[model samples]
Target: MNLVENLVVFAHGKESGPWGTKITHLAETARGRGFEVMSPDYSHTHDPRERVAQLLALAPTAKRLVLVGSSMGGYVSAQACATLKPQALFLMAPALYFTGWDEEPQGVPALCSVVHGWHDDIVPMERGLRFAKSNHATLHVLNSDHGLNDQLAALALLFGDFLDQVKTEIL
Candidate 1:
């Protein structure tokens, strides 16, 4: 499979400052698979608009982008990538409605998949469903926790699968 050229990840529930282990791990995975990754720090679920701007700004090549987000980060990605038309996106336990989340994503880009954990605590699974439905995107449901750190292999495989689906395609 052709490796992605630009891959970006978003961190949730804190200012995870670029080097957060999950972000780094995923980055390393993408790198090992042959891709440059952008990991940005955003504080929790608050200020979705600003956070979205930060993520979008990091991508050097606008359309050939792969966005991966977890929890609140997933929400941020959904809200931001709604219009950017990235190459593909993979969201883990995405939460569309948060305590302080104010912005409503018009829609996610067609090249998007929002992953949900049926047993997530931080973000309910139904939220992911709603987001996927509104955007006319794909929804990948798993039986896991909020971060989905436990399902590392599955998550990686899913991302890789999406990469394969979008590679050399017209998205």
Candidate 2:
């Protein structure tokens, strides 16, 4: 994959920054695969809509686009998909179907994958299951919590595999 043609954009969770451990690790994985990576800071605002708007405004155009998000950022990435139309989407413990956020995603990319912690205390695993089932996404339920900090190595492997699948599909 040409670095100029492939891009992976990561949206961190509500409390996490752009360069959090997960993002940093995954960014390395993406870069190693010859894809340019970006993680926009959305810490200034807790509002999901604003984060979505910021991502839409900031994401650069690329021939092959992949969006990855965690928790609230997952919601942001999924919402942005209507306009961004990314070739692939990867989500971790996405906070979907929450009470305040009215705009649930109507559509997702064919190459969508989701990783949710079975022990998540914030976002229920059932939410992720429903979203994945409805969208026909590849879902992985792990034995971890909301942060999934303990499962970093597993996350990296799953994410790398997801990117590889995306690359294969595009080619």
Candidate 3:
């Protein structure tokens, strides 16, 4: 019997690239936990729906799937979850319920976690809270900004713990 390896796909923010600082760090953490990782580049379009389509098309099938997103990418990941049906989701400062996006974010993975910055100027903390509350996702509100660049180390630790929990649950 062929066993498909676990997969982790990362969706970068509107302004960040696929291998930005946070993604690079968290990808390493995921890798250390024996999971395959991929970050699709959505730099071509600023449209969230387009980004979601790109993710849906590119994400490969795996025995266990984990989707991670930041800022607008978080919205893309959540939207893709409707079709992908990933096992887990990790979002950082996700841009949900913002202007210009017509559809409300949907799809709830079995395990969902969010890390939001209290000082986020781009996406308000309240928006993150609302998303977390509605989805019943684990939330971590940090003392940082929208980028959460200053909390990279803490993010790595949190992501590692999250991945461990996912591993345990899937087993």
> Would you give me the overall lDDT of model 3?
0.89
- Candidates' C-alpha lDDT: 0.68, 0.90, 0.89
lDDT of 3 at 82: 83
Error of 3 at 119 (Å): 0.4
* Per-residue lDDT value at 116 in model 1: 79
Looking at model 3, residue 70 earns an lDDT score of 97
lDDT of 3 at 7: 88
**Model 2 C-alpha lDDT per residue in residues 75-131, reported as the tens digit of each score:** 999999989889999999999999889566955899999999989999999999988
Backbone clash pairs in model 1 (N, Cα, C under 3 Å; residues 3+ apart or in different chains), count: 0
Local accuracy of candidate 1 as per-residue lDDT tens digits, 1-171: 464555555455443455665666677667665567766667543666677777667643533677777776776676666565666777877767776774567645577887777788777788888878877878888878876767777777777667666666734
Q: Which has the higher lDDT value, candidate number 1 or candidate number 3?
A: 3
Q: TM-score of every model?
A: 0.80, 0.95, 0.95
The TM-score-based order of candidates, best leading, equals 2, 3, 1
RMSD of each: 3.9, 2.0, 1.5
Winner by lDDT between candidate 3 and candidate 2: 2
Task: Please state the error at residue 120 of candidate 3 in Å.
Answer: 0.3
Number of the candidate with higher TM-score, 1 or 3: 3
